[model samples]
Target chain A: MTLPRRGPWRIVFVAALVVAAVIFVIPFVWLVSASLREPGYVFSTGLLPLPFHPENYREAFQAVPLPLWLFNSAVVGTAAAVSVTLSSAWVAFGFAYFRFPGRDLLFGLVLATMMLPFAVTMIPTYLIWSELKLTDTQVPLWAGNLFGSAFYIFLLRQFLLSLPRELFEAARVDGASYPALFWRVAFPLIRPALLVVLVFEFKASWTDLVKPLIYLRDESLFTLPRGLKVVLDRFGVRRRAGLAHRARGQRHRHDPDDHRVLPRPAPLHRRHRDHGPQGLSRARSGPCGRRGRWPSGSPRPAPPWSSGSGP
Target chain B: MAAPRRRPTLARREARWGVLFLAPWLVGFLVFYAGPMVASLWLSFTDYDIVNPPRFVGLDNYRQMLADPMVARSLRNTVYYTVLHVPLTMAISLGLALLLNRVGRLSGFFRTVFYLPVMTPAVAVGILFLLLLNTQDGLVNGFLGWFGIDGPSWTTDPAWVMPGIVLMSLWSLGSTVVIYLAALQNVPRELHEAATVDGAGSWQRFRSVTLPMISGALFFTLIVNTIAALQMFTEVYTMFFGNQSTQQRFDADASTFYVIYLFQQAFQFLHMGFASALAWLLFLVILVITVVQLRLSKRWVYYESEES
Candidate 1:
């Protein structure tokens, strides 16, 4: 099964590796290039930054509460990671150390929960939070982790099982309390698994848009992903805003250097209050263009002066 | 019962301690999982708006689902996406793992390059792919144009939307690649050598020896990926429905997945009961699919323990 060390086979192998590497890396290059362009040139076909406008970063910062969102995301991610790690580890230790009545059945129940879709419990869970008067608060986002996620419990339990029973027994013989047995003996041994749980849960919390979309309505309370959703709503979807502004014969006020701009879409403050149930209906009739006029329906609008052609 | 009047046995004492340690999860199970599950099942039979008490509707919600066009469309869309996504992910990951397994010192670098996208937040990936999949000026289309292929309008076309999503999902197949790589490394070299001595060519060795050796990981990933693909939300939602303002502009019917429809029912339309029914339906689908997969695995998946 080993690749031939020398000849045309080695050359082909290297070429394949290089091609795969380029395919994987190019999207990131395109992302950085697009981010650097003047907002007008974002959709312009390019894989390289020729005329970079670093000011776009500054404008984006001023346009949105990016710092506040980052802070909120960090807090939520840390809380979720730390709580799930600690709680899942504790539960896993119990499963690993003790042979109790109905233990196998209980463990099976825990594993079965992994198969249950979150959609089933989502509505009831929301109702539970609303009943506790905690809806729209950050508590709903990370507080559930205190209960220990089933997946993490199962993962950490597997790690704990690999440890020799004699190590725990030795500690018990030395008059260690049960909690002390876990803390002093098993805890240190499973540090790597705990770390894995921490990282995974943190990523889960950080990337989570649905939970925040469901729970948080306040603008100031938004995590990074939720804030990004708002950003996409305003800027990402309607790339034609700049052209529409120029066609209307009004120069955007703030930047004399850039004529290809319009005033920021509806005030951020307006959206803050309008995120209620009524907002859902309002959004149905929002200012988005008609479906018939989608970019795909018409000929490719000649990339607003394409500098980088098909690269 | 009378025998229990004696001092607690060592085993009983240990069991008490075990229960004590398990208290947090026990409480969590009651509050978060068991309680909500029961409530969800009950709510599925009632008409519930958040403001008012639930009115028992006696299976009307389930009956509505039977006639709901959107429910059927969403399920079809999910199944289509699952069929496309799960196999592609598994195959590509296995391919990448095989490639990586052949490499020597540069393996870690390639592995990291592949896994990096998995670490990127799904929302970020969604946004990035939205830009990359843009019909006219997108990087993907641009790449295709280099090959003289006319790229379809990925996000806007109903026919191509699921394929677009499948492509985006493949970017995060790095996790699966890592899993497959682990499994591949665990395949005993002696088995391959033994096969080679028995007049097996490389392809024959791969088909006979490599496939079965890694079938457990393959089966595990198949089930996990199938379940995940069916439940897919964050990335699809971010790319397609993140903007409520422009949500209608896209091919809504085509891209509307089962979970998305469920979310709409529970949250947007306030059809909480209907949403619960939708959830239960999904649960049953998953249960049936998993059971079938396990059964089918008996024919193909070779376990060393079973062989012994």
Candidate 2:
């Protein structure tokens, strides 16, 4: 324990690592806990609830049209991912592996967009989409990905450049056209990079709340984030009713008064007859908040979608 | 090794194939990028609200933004966020990369663990943080109690709000770590061997040799990171803080950033001319800062196969 014997650096390093790990871990655990807290107590209750409210998850499911939004996100993100991957890989093979005219100048133009602020093009893109009659559809989200983003093309080109020249030469010897070589040979080799593009693009499109909020106005066409936005806007009388159901269903207790915790009187959930004033409000409050796949804070995406703001 | 006549044919063929393949991205850039950019610049000079036929008002919008205080504050906050977040992220990611490089057991597992956050949809990540950072009974405050620390109400508190964004930003530092890890692999073993032979310890070697070797990557990440931070939108606007109307919820003078204001002006208020003007200003700021960085990079950014 002497200063000469024990280095403080070891202690600090371990502490930093441990704290970072805890910082990462606790929130995920708390999210799951918050989602399951009793309907009355969920928001009112802290991160650690004594009892699990199974109903919160059930209520969350009912509140949002989960299946449809999820399906919408999947279809949009997946289609975008697939098309972008192909386009990027093909374009990258040309940029990286081949010696071409105007290649550097062309790439310079493409790279220039990497610095583009969406503000520059957002309005014009909107006008274009409207004129194309594609403003309200999922087309805005997916179609751009098909054309291959300059970013992915650049990243893939960097990767392809590092690869050896022998493989492409071998493919060409067999009379493979550039397309055939790209598809049959280089494609499989670059599959790992392709996967990276897939996951990244998928995440980009999947979590893209702003564009969807703008383009897709129909409630039926709403994505998960868009649906959750509705829940975020409400500061209503039912806040108490929402908490009341959570209080009764909640298992653990550090707080003494569940009644005082809620902002308003508990609204009744028709299913929770025993838990009075809980079910009715939630039924009307709709599919939102700390539970199931959707979670809360998303229900009322401010009318800025078509007008602007969410992105 | 081939015939001399074949060289021209080879170059011609490659040129043809390259254009054919690059056609998609070129077309995309022309239509989506160049076209929009030029149109946006034109719109900046005129009063166009998407509905109105653009009326040329000269430099009026730019003049208005010059007087707007919100634009300045937003830029300040964004710079503040970048200043705080980028170094913290780079340090943490570099540290993680070093640890992963040394450790033999479960390195991939750690890598995977670090990256798990990337899988969660961003809004889900935001909502999840809403619960964790809740002031009253949130887990953060609860845990802070064990250490005699009182956690601030993250989202609601203006002072602490960007700090929450910083924390949220770090959760996705997985990508940064990956980039660092790849750069670390390219460090020449012989250079390290020479340094060690000169009686350099691990820390000394890292400082003198490893650091210089990774300067290329370091420069790339710095520019890319700064650019990303400058363009930061969704997480701040969607989760921790919001843009425009939400700014009205707190009011404009309180604590919003420039990008957020630009977003509000362009989208919410339908101040297309003003927004376009603001966009041009931002473009200039980014362009100027980047050129300065590039010019300054002469001192530190070293490449192995390039002119000194």
Candidate 3:
């Protein structure tokens, strides 16, 4: 255990660590460099931001409602975090403090729910929201957290269990009411664990794309992830535009009307249409290169569908 | 008699308080989880689009799924991802954690650096990796080219798609590393010292002293990462299929994980009943895998209480 700190091994270890750290970090570095490049040079084989076009940021915001999406994400993340933290804490406290019949069984059920895939509950949950006329609204995104999440409940319960039962017993002996024992005694004591749950749930909510994709059909109501999805769909083919421009040997100018390079948004009603299985089949067989599809005449991007041949 | 009666009432009061505290979860369990579960199970048995009343069509959805090539394709894709992603992530994270445990002065800085990726939103990670994994001009390929390695077309080739996704998932191995670091820290230092005194080599000491102590965390991560890899959706969906509004181009069949297929069935195709069946199948697969893991854990997962 007392191996000498200063040695050839030490130098090797530090070098390895540095290499690993750089490997992990290079993606963000590349993204930043790519973001600053001229549209034509974005797919160019360089890591530096040569011919920097900071206007890409301004154009991106204008192209999509970034600020609105950010605000919506913050709101949804906050609501989900706060509600899940409080509710899960309350439920955890109950399980931790209580001595009642079926408590173990109920707690076991809560733990079991963690293993149940969301896909199992997804459809009927959608149905329930639809029945309540809450679809396309933000209500379905965070409102479900009012009923404590099983994972958070299990987490907080473990935290609560670590607390001394004597502390709660002392409060009860002081003629403190049950609710007072929870709010006054236990809640403050579990603040750190509650913060953990809050942060985890908030991150989950912020990063979540599935719920938003399923529920928030309205562009204005979109969370960041959903909004980003829209951005990806609309601008996914921008690389093709870059390729086309490059093929013609034209230097790309950063144009304000670059948004026009995107296909027009489908009409709201038509975009939201409920395509049945038949429509799905038809769409599946439809022509390529529309929307997020690879633009037809351009050289195909490397990855997913393309062969290994360099474009 | 009076004393006994008071005892009963006191116990009753505590029970009532317990029920009151637990009421929210109980209601949530029933309304959100239990009710929907039952409804979905029923829905799986019927033929229902959102617009129409469900018509009973027992076993038809399940039968269709058996014949559905996409179902098999998606399952194979998911399993491929899980098999690759889980073990590689575990090994890499554990290795990082072990190294972090050795460092004294700069461990916190390194840990923070490693964990920064875990905080990046999945959608952002997807986009970032999408760009970074591009074969022709990607930074990854550019880096590989430094060693004269020709990187495969990551997102484009069906053969390499899952591997690409695995690489992307590895980028967020920070959380797993952090978990392992915590577990490594908890492995009593004295045990390692004792093993050293007993003439055990560093490798031997680690294999015996270090691993068993952290087996619980390792097992927990295994189950969690397995479940997560199976349900892998957001990043893959974002990278490959996020732009479904576009016309059908080349099929990224390998990228279509099970959940993505379920999502398309339910939302895009409005085949709610069929989607429900797909979901239930996933549920059963997850259940079986989890059960198998739990059973297997008894052999290797160490619990301090059991020795006591």
Candidate 4:
């Protein structure tokens, strides 16, 4: 299509795009704003953060085991990405370059496996891992990638199919080992597909919540998403009417709803003190104010009732 | 290109190399995927808790699933979500792609901006959107307030929870948009020019020339988005009830998706047998839907190279 040559239509087109972009970006902008703001200003509606506290990130780090969680996420993500990419490329090359019996059938089988959803195999797979004492470890999460994934293999095979077969033949004739031919010739030619596999596998591992939720028991072993869940559950406001009711200044001071929204900073800080140096600060800037739940007066959470104690 | 040198020994060795290369994946399939598939099928017919040996129950688990209210609710919720989500996502992604395709110079910049959402971790997106869709101080409600419209309590209200999740799901339209963009760019410009010369207007040219070329991508995104919507978990899980506490509970009734219920049955409740039956049912549903989609694609999906 021709450009509209600086007409009003062009301006309208650009303006519409800008609006869409802003709408897409507002969540991220809110995350950044909420993360940076002082605990008191979290309920503020304005976009630009007032009394910006970059220290909340430091406190966020202190509040939870952020470093450990980040580290675990990296390890699993990298392992899955690297293993999936290499194995998928290796398997794809075998299918693409070699003229073997059952090659088409085997590749078809690989594609067919993609149809089976994870839930179908999830329970038995977990049992197998548990039986092998692999549960509660990071192994189960990334080990599946050691055997080439069906989707990645299919993707790489399609890419390999497009490349001239001559490259592999030429490399083979040059006295190169079969493995060497794959590594030197086929692997380099399929770099884009490999990169795609790497990114896909990394992101899949990084954001996976179910596998970790099932496999991991130890809090120390949790990944970022798991840790984030812990933080949200611990600090998030729960009542359905909390945010809206509080916003209108109609909230009763002694109501149970009030306790769910307000963060009792001193007690929370004291609790965090046992965990780490910055736990208190983390609690102060936690999911409470980010929720914009309460306008005032912090309510203390009731202590858990002891067994055999009557209400 | 190398010459077709058919050395007898080398050809024989190539077959050996091929099997050797396939061995890793083959072993993986047997041990991980194939083995578990069989095991789960067996497990579905029995009462199995993780701690004890599985006992044969002879379709009891499946029978129980038929009676379970949550199973029906979950299925209804999943179907509702998939029905709403897949079509809306297709429309939005296609619209974005068409918009990006028309804007010449800044398309690259806008494309990057649009694609940014897909790169953010899904868990992070969930949490971010949870806050963004809050009833009172959320950016969404704040925007709605500008027009004097009171936004529903998105996060907490059972009625609005799935809609909130669906809106959040739209943020990850980047990958679909990219696929559509690639397909859009591939539509033969000659077809457009010819149609224009034939006095076809822009909409008519697009309908007759552009859409047919991109039908393959449309078919692909449809199948993918449907399958994905059926498995909706992380976003809804994070937004409504986190994993920390009440990990067993499907808090908001409307947001209890099929996969999430399956997950709770297997892990939280330790009803592995029942969950397996639920899973097999899900498998059948997906298989049927996919087969139906593939069948339906013959009607609308245009392949440029196919002989009529």
TM-score of each: 0.88, 0.80, 0.88, 0.86
Model 1 docking tier (incorrect/acceptable/medium/high): acceptable
lDDT of 4 by residue, B1-308 (tens): 24555566677888998999999999999988899999999999987756456788887777677766778899999998898899999999998888788777787888888899988877678777766776766788898999999998786666887788888999888889989988988887778778888999988987878888899999999999999899888887766543322222224567789998787667654667878999999999999999999999999999978956
From the highest lDDT down, the ranking of the candidates is 1, 3, 4, 2
Candidates' C-alpha lDDT: 0.78, 0.66, 0.78, 0.75
TM-score of chain B of each: 0.96, 0.88, 0.96, 0.94
TM-score of 1: 0.88
Candidate 4 residue pairs in backbone clash: none
Q: Which of 2 and 4 is the better model by TM-score?
A: 4
- Model 3, A269-300: lDDT tens per residue? 54443111122223334632223222222222
RMSD of each: 8.7, 8.8, 7.2, 8.6
Clashing pairs in 3: A303-B155, A303-B156, A303-B157, A304-B155, A304-B156, A304-B157, A305-B156
Looking at candidate 3, what is the lDDT of residue A130? 81
Candidate 2 residue spans exceeding 4 A from truth: A1-19, A43-49, A96-99, A158-178, A234-311, B1-17, B185-197, B201-203, B240-255
The DockQ of predicted model 4 stands at 0.36
Q: Which of 2 and 3 is the better model by lDDT?
A: 3
The TM-score obtained for chain B of candidate 1 when compared with the true chain B:
0.96
Q: What's the TM-score of chain A alone for every prediction?
A: 0.79, 0.72, 0.78, 0.76
* Arranged by DockQ, best first: 3, 4, 1, 2
What does the lDDT come to for candidate 2? Answer: 0.66
Mark the regions of model 1 whose C-alpha exceeds 4 Å error after superposition: A1-7, A237-264, A267-311, B1-9
Between candidates 3 and 4, name the one with more favorable lDDT. 3
Which candidate has the top score in DockQ? Answer: 3
